[model samples]
Target: MDVTPVMSSASTPATGTTGSLAAMAQQAWGALSYAARTVGVPAGVRGLAVEVAYTAVHLSVYPWGLLDEALRPGGVHAHHRTDSLPPYERSRLVSDLDGSSTPVLLVHGIVDNRSIFHYLARTLRRRGHGTVQAVNYSPLTAFTGDIRTAARDLGDHVERLCAVSGVDRVHIVGHSLGGLISRYYVQRLGGDARVDTLVTLGTPHRGSAIAHLLPPTLVPRQLQPGSDLLRELEEPAPDCRTRFLAVWSRMDQLIIPQRNARLEHPDLDVENVRLEHVGHMAMTIDPEVVHLVACRLGRTRSPRDRIAPVAAAG
Candidate 1:
């Protein structure tokens, strides 16, 4: 017997084969779990999940509203070419300025283009509000420079809107960081005279801690609590003539401790409207908010009435 034991040619290593199959199964399960968490859970959750996903996408890939123009055909341009147009042509609003009451200038927040206001703009128009124009600032600008520059640009746009509409004062509606910009214009840039009413939705007037999650860019830094820009904005504005209405949501994920959206300045005329279960982005398109804004714009309030900060549950 040359070979003590003859190995069976057809025999397989059962333990090794079983171990490999188990490893593959585990890997497959991990992939499936990841997919479910990313796609399935977010789809079901809806509110905060949608906002978070949108924000993440905006920050990571679509910063500065890139590809937004592609999404919206013939919508408002990211950069208005008023400089090229004649005064007569430039003065015209999206809707007929003459027929509308007070012209409304809509300012979008960080990394957002004018398209974000499409639904709200249409709603305002349907409700018979005046010229609803939206402005888009460079997302990179917000990340690189002071917000005051955007406020200055806003001032320029406001002046143009007023000049074209033949209105002495225009109403301003700002969302998120745009609210901060409008506030800076009103408080620091002497825009109170030109702006009659300012309505802010989900704006962090006192700044937000969640800003820390963003890169330490100029505007993000400015948005952090106790930043210089916010401190300056907090200063007394005794002469500010603008009436401010702050609409904030309890479910807003961006503005941590959401009360930061309230305008707490003593000298300014401010009001707080609390919205429940509304995400930050949804505020711009909310029907109840739009109706409330229309009512505010439609009626004329006395100075005494505008001075007090009133809180209402929405």
Candidate 2:
């Protein structure tokens, strides 16, 4: 009976097993914490928090101004709340030009109406960048219809704006998908003849990975990396006369790997402006962005000035 020392395998832990289990437990806790901080919170609750913060700031800083802007006739709210207005009326609202001046067309991103340009338009107007207008297109249309169709529509608006403003060329500013539409019009649709300078904010020129997160609809598909539409857009535009200024933020939540917002065409005149800690939506409201846009609009520089493409600024 030599049963002196019998050690069970289950009783003795293997070498590094304790460390591995501890590491796994730590990883699990970290994942749980991250989920709690992000997806665990109700979307409505987050929205409400943002609204509450905005309301508080509005009331505390400029209560009367906010009320007037909201309630007054032909005010921000009245003008932006154009859902009931006819298509012609909306277009007219955008194309209203008082005198002969360099027209600035504002194009908003996907799923957004022209109302998003309210603050930016006002800022441009105040900065004396006369005749600022915004164009609205359907997000569903972008999904169902080809992007070229949207470009054609934008071209039509540009032509109308130029005709009304008595200007042969207009400066275009677009955000997100609007920027893509503008570029298509300028490069592929021979819109460079009509557009002098093209400014884009938070645009995805190289396509965006975030598009994959969206439904596999037409627009999203077109916006994904290496899409046919994007490939066509990336083609050389040697004769394009438009000067491009691409403005992007480092912390843009929508444009995945934010550098996608930059324009990298070799044959075209493209400049990149980097913004710090600015969100995609805030790009339209930020004073610095407004000032940059105003300065670019204020002066009429020759296209040759942009011959050295790929200029960068902070």
Candidate 3:
């Protein structure tokens, strides 16, 4: 993505001042008020019951997502073309000041397939997003695949998508283990050059204890709390250009302490969005998560807009 600096003189009367103390104070007070209003867990009984039911639904849909989706020549379908949208629909869908047509790819968690993204993909298209795709990594690969190996494969996939779509950069949204894999690709494998934004939902950025409870496998071993693979990811990635957003849920059952999902590396630009009442498997279908993703992905990439969205839902 091109990094240009500044707004036109008409919008920002002051030439050099990027921020002001008074404005910050008002923002802080507003954030505090919003946080106070949203303090609760698991969205109450309704959310938990729905989460349980969705697991079975997702399982039944899993087989349908097993086959890799064929790459389209133009990256998106007929309706996703923004120019073809009717005026009213276009106004509702194109929220960005610069109208980014960035292609989005959804990566699923372990033992899950692209089927998890059915709701999210359709929602994004309705929001006027140009291209949305989902990829599946085989569960059989777990016996031989480690994080770096999977990351290498992911890198190749991103390159192909960029080429096929004829776009300079793409945004990635990874769920659970898929997030970790995408992170390794961006930070360690130089995928930052191609991936504009990387959003992780319920990913274990600090590693998770659940891996230790499960039987050892090539991938699970790498996901353990203190594994060498996780340690490597902890290393400084100051040069990575891709923006990071880690969306973690308080009710996620698979991530041992739950808090491990937050990405706190000092070197990277990361925004952490906290969620409540959503579980691991249910995150993709959750309305709050789907909306947050659509809003973030729809925004134009500018240096100024990259720093906000803190505790968006508390």
Candidate 4:
């Protein structure tokens, strides 16, 4: 049996490993024209040129996120409450434990650490999400570990966050491969019990053709189209209660067709939103993405029957 990604025609460049990215940039420049106009940025080649520069900037940020983050101390745990407070003050404390105070967990993609959310976390806090934080799975897992094992570890992290935050549920924003690990936890490992909303940015929900270019290592093999792991995720998920918001970008060269980022399952409650001119790594810091994520977490907007292009205010 032939086992490879559906888009096997996506060939690597003769120059070397990175030459493929340069080729994708050229394609992105052509495809990004209309999207650039929508965001009032320079069109076509110029738009993707900026994205290339941002990719370099994101590389500088990778070092800062090398270590796991410490849990911020702000959860309204029961031990912290007291009876000596005024009635009005006590009521406020009670409200803090309600759904309004649900925690937000940020998960980074393969080969990355919690530092990917440096800007996104700060932006969420600035937008009034008090408990926004990130959990860094081991970077080695991207190449050497089973995704199922990683999901189990993530579930453990979620439980710890719940214990400290005094809330039963949380909202998650997973970038790229991080999104896959999180979904495996949610759908296959019964994580819907804890996660209320899962937002995946640049996640290849249907598998990415780019994985075919790499050697068939354990984890990368699973990321290829029609891999066993992807097949397992495609299985029926009838009772999943957690909501999903999948964000895909037109200028994301890493995901190959880019539409691979869209999540389309028959039984899951999902909303897919598309954006133009944003690169795979740029999803976290893009002003529009930050604004949309804030609105979703803050409950500023209701679910829509149709997916629409949203532009953030300046």
Give the candidate number with the greatest TM-score.
Answer: 3
How many angstroms is residue 26 displaced in model 4 relative to the true structure, after the best TM-score fit?
17
Each model's Cα RMSD: 15.4, 12.1, 17.1, 9.9
Pairs in steric clash, model 4: 109-178
Question: Could you tell me the TM-score of candidate 2?
Answer: 0.67
Candidate 1 lDDT over 68-160, as tens digits, reads: 545654333333344554444444433444324577788888777666676777776655554677777776866686799989999998887
Report the lDDT of model 3 for residue 73: 35
How accurate locally is residue 305 in candidate 4, as Cα lDDT from 0 to 100? 12
lDDT for predicted candidate 4 compared with the true structure = 0.77
TM-score of each: 0.68, 0.67, 0.77, 0.74
* Residue lDDT tens for model 2, 9-91: 65445545887898999988975664454434564345335435543543354434334434553322223333555564345
CA lDDT of each prediction against the hidden true structure: 0.74, 0.73, 0.78, 0.77
The list of candidate 2 runs beyond 4 A from truth reads: 1-100, 302-314
Sorted on lDDT, best first, the list reads 3, 4, 1, 2
Which candidate, 2 or 3, has the higher lDDT? Answer: 3
Candidate 4, which ten residues in sequence have the lowest lDDT sum?
Answer: 305-314
Model 3 per-residue lDDT tens digits across residues 1-314: 55344435555645234457667788889756643443343354556677789998988877777643543333354445557776754775456524346778888888777889999988886777667888888776556667788889988888887777677688999999899999999999988877878999999998888888766887888888888888998898865678888999767778866789999998888999988777788888888889998888875475434323322322
lDDT of 4 by residue, 41-144 (tens): 56545547767786787788777666334343332243333355456545543654343366789999888887878888877655445477787778889678
Q: Identify the runs in model 3 with alpha carbons over 4 angstroms from their true place.
A: 1-42, 67-89, 92-99, 302-314
Error of 4 at 123 (Å): 1.2
